[model samples]
Target: MTSTPAFPPLKTYLTIIACALLLGGCSSGDEPASEPPRVALVEPLQPAEPQPEALRLSGVVQSVTTTQLSFEVAGRIERILIDEGTRIRRGQPLAELDRVDYQLQLSEAEARLRQLQADLARKRTLLAEGILAPAAIEALEANTVAARVARDSARRDLERSTLSAPFDGVVARRLVEPNMVVAVGTPVFEMQDNRHIEVSVDLPEIAALSIPLGPELKAEGQLVIADVSLPLRYKEHSTQPREGARTYRLVLQGEPPEDYNLLPGMAMRVSVQRPPRPQASQDQFRLPLSALQADSDGGHYIWQAADGRARRLAVELQEVEGDQALIRGDGLQAQLPIIVAGGSKLHEEQPIKVQERN
Candidate 1:
């Protein structure tokens, strides 16, 4: 009876109960949300792979020896056997000149020799018999010697009328035609042997002296188009590459592939495998030149990967090559393949996705 008197109506009681229940529900403890599986939002921190050590050298391609063949005597070119770019062997005839004059001179000398020999013989017999003086015998002997000398001269002249290859090589220039008149010392053929081509390139002074002689330093030279790598023998180094420049000249010997067919005066790129300079203690890490970034404290650092996360590593730059920078420091291992080509836009601790290069 007392509870009924206090409550204004059952509906009001119900409304109050509902409000209390709603408050209780709002204040009650909430069920904890399941974490997003602690997924490592990071790129794979794969160890850097062993990098290929190479020296990139660029210069002009040239031959060790280029033969410029010339005519020893003046005459008209009668028969030209070989054309330009023809491969010639040693002592092979290249051209021939008119030898009728030389043959006539040779014939005249031979006749004179016979006459002189006859005169000498007659004079000797007369002197022996006391009919002629010894002076006559001596004069006949001198005449015979002079005739022999003339014949020898004619023989040399005949030989000079023909052009022969001195060594095996490919003909580079054929400057004369079959009927062209050539003079003494006139260059009619230029030849070169491509079996072993010399690649002469300049290196910085520090790099030149550091390179040792012998077979240990042959560069693995490869042609870009052909993509064939060949060994380059260290032939020579210039004492003074150039004044005021810390550089030296290096000569490498090797034969390019048949498809490449390198020519003299042609430019090519050479890949030189440069191990860490001798006695250099620190390991070398080659990265893109653009990978360097200066911090506010003026410290140099590069983007390093750690635990599938991006990290900033303090690094010291040692040298710089085209599109590459050599750095040294910890947190970098040779087994890890660093970001070389694309590493410009990256931040510390930021997630990264490695895009495979095609």
Candidate 2:
């Protein structure tokens, strides 16, 4: 005991040593440790080819002249000569109504007219021979004139029972069938002149002011559909904006190309290329719409890949056509990779793992 200097028991010593070791372990664990940052996959931006700066719009093909035809008189439809989409010429018989009643009326009127004419002639002869009073002859003359008018009216009514085309056009709609009873002024056909087609494009007020309109301007236009381009002539522009939109309508007038068939209500891409100003740059590029993002200040920006990192750059969003967005910005190069997807969450110059686009 004296030699050990009255040290604690073996059990107490062991417990103290254990507690010290535990405290040291906890302290070491409290120190911060390093971690590898997550890498986002990225790809090179495929910038679209830079072409002449022009605005491309969407429009619909419509007939320049359309008319709704109706029966002038009420009757039962007896026959329909033309069907929908049938090409018709001016004065073509398109339909007919039951004319039996009209025929009978005309016949009765003619018979009455003959009797009045005979009476009038007899009365005139008697008056010329001084056998009848002039007043009585005048009465007979009035009767004859009234009978002739009645006959002419009956004949005109019979003629109106047959429907005829007023102009050369295509029958766009047939609203009635044979033997269908229709009232007066009931629409029976919808006809359109497709030979002279018009493409109506809606444009913003700012844009409408830039493009010259009217036949004199003849702004170069093309109605593109299914990859087919047809030249168009500038016809007119609306001075008033369309309802529910702050855009005016610009109408392009032209005939379909030779042997190229176009119908009303068909959709087409309309391109109106304005003469490039000397100060305007022809540089423009297209990218997937996803690559574009909006800023809180009403501006748009995109993320481009540079030196294995995401580089954010501001861009001017020109227009959106289909799945692509046309953009114009400074120092934008073709074939430069831009982040198409997962770019909204990325920070500028963030480390990105290059990968092929899925």
Question: What lDDT score belongs to each candidate, Candidate 1 first?
Answer: 0.72, 0.80
| Number of backbone-clashing residue pairs for each candidate, in the order shown | 12, 3
lDDT of 1 by residue, 1-358 (tens): 4564564879998999999998987789666664331122222222222444666778567887798888888888899999887877889999999888888989999999999898888778888899988776777788899999999998999998988988877899888888888889988988898778888887876666555645677576655455566677777767775777777777888876766667787766776665553434446666666666667787677765555556677887776667666677777766453443334556666565544333
The candidate 2 region of ten consecutive residues with least summed lDDT is: 34-43
lDDT of 2 by residue, 182-230 (tens): 9999999999986788888888877776666655444334445555567
Query: Could you tell me every candidate's TM-score relative to the true structure?
Result: 0.60, 0.60
Q: Record all residue pairs in model 2 with backbone atoms less than 3 Å apart, i.e. clashing.
A: 44-337, 45-337, 45-338
How close to the true structure is residue 76 of candidate 2, measured as C-alpha lDDT?
Answer: 98
